[model samples]
Target: MGIISMIIIGLIAGAIARLLVPGKENFGWIGTILLGIVGGYVGGTLGSMVFAPHKFTVQPPVNHAFLGAIVGAVILLVIYKFVRARV
Candidate 1:
């Protein structure tokens, strides 16, 4: 909820996501944090749509959010790779 907590979660989620995906990511600490933060937003949004479409205030638990963050980060990384390759 706090800024510090968000940053920490982002770092962990980003690190785990990088490990799960099988490519070399050149981004460093700050990039990782940004990736995680964006991934968290994407994950939270998707989770909300999938799990509770009618409730606006409903939020997933922290653990579920964490997992979703990782999944989201992995997806972003894959997309980035594809886009970069095409550029």
Candidate 2:
């Protein structure tokens, strides 16, 4: 996917993730976008490992990527909360 596509997907995925995970996130639009982008990479990597261990590809399908992005974002958000609480 192109940079713009990634950004758009990231925005959507981030927004959806924020909605699913209930809590107060201080970050705004840019932070959300970055979270989603990172989540996409994290999710895509893990998804490939689980789903297609043998056939590892750099880019997963759009649907899978979207789902993975949300899951990844949620995981990150949870981790963030935990770290914040400890600090």
Candidate 3:
């Protein structure tokens, strides 16, 4: 996939993830996009470790990007909440 498409997907995934997780996220649109991009990377890394083993990049055939993004976003959100509470 292209960088543009990935970014778009990331934005959408982040928004969806934020919605799925009930809480007040202190981030704007840009932050959401960044969150999603990071989430995608995190998801891709974890998925690769679990499913592909040797591979690092997830291809279109697997199309685990969205799922991975959601999982990653949830994780990040949780961490963010925890840290924010502490601070």
Q: How far off is residue 22 in model 2, in Å?
A: 1.2
Cα lDDT tens digits, model 3, 1-87, are 898987898899899889988889879998899889899888878887888555657555655678998788878888888998899
TM-score of each: 0.85, 0.85, 0.81
Give the number of colliding residue pairs in candidate 1. 0
Clashes of each: 0, 0, 0
Whole-model lDDT values for every prediction: 0.86, 0.85, 0.84
Worst 10 residues of 2 by lDDT: 53-62
Candidate numbers, best TM-score first, in rank order: 1, 2, 3
Each prediction's RMSD to truth: 3.4, 3.9, 3.7
Worst 10 residues of 3 by lDDT: 53-62
lDDT per residue, candidate 1, 49-72, as tens digits?
888645538664557889878888
Candidate 3 Cα RMSD (Å): 3.7
Question: How far does residue 75 in candidate 1 sit from its true spot (Å)?
Answer: 1.2
- Report the lDDT of model 3 for residue 16: 86
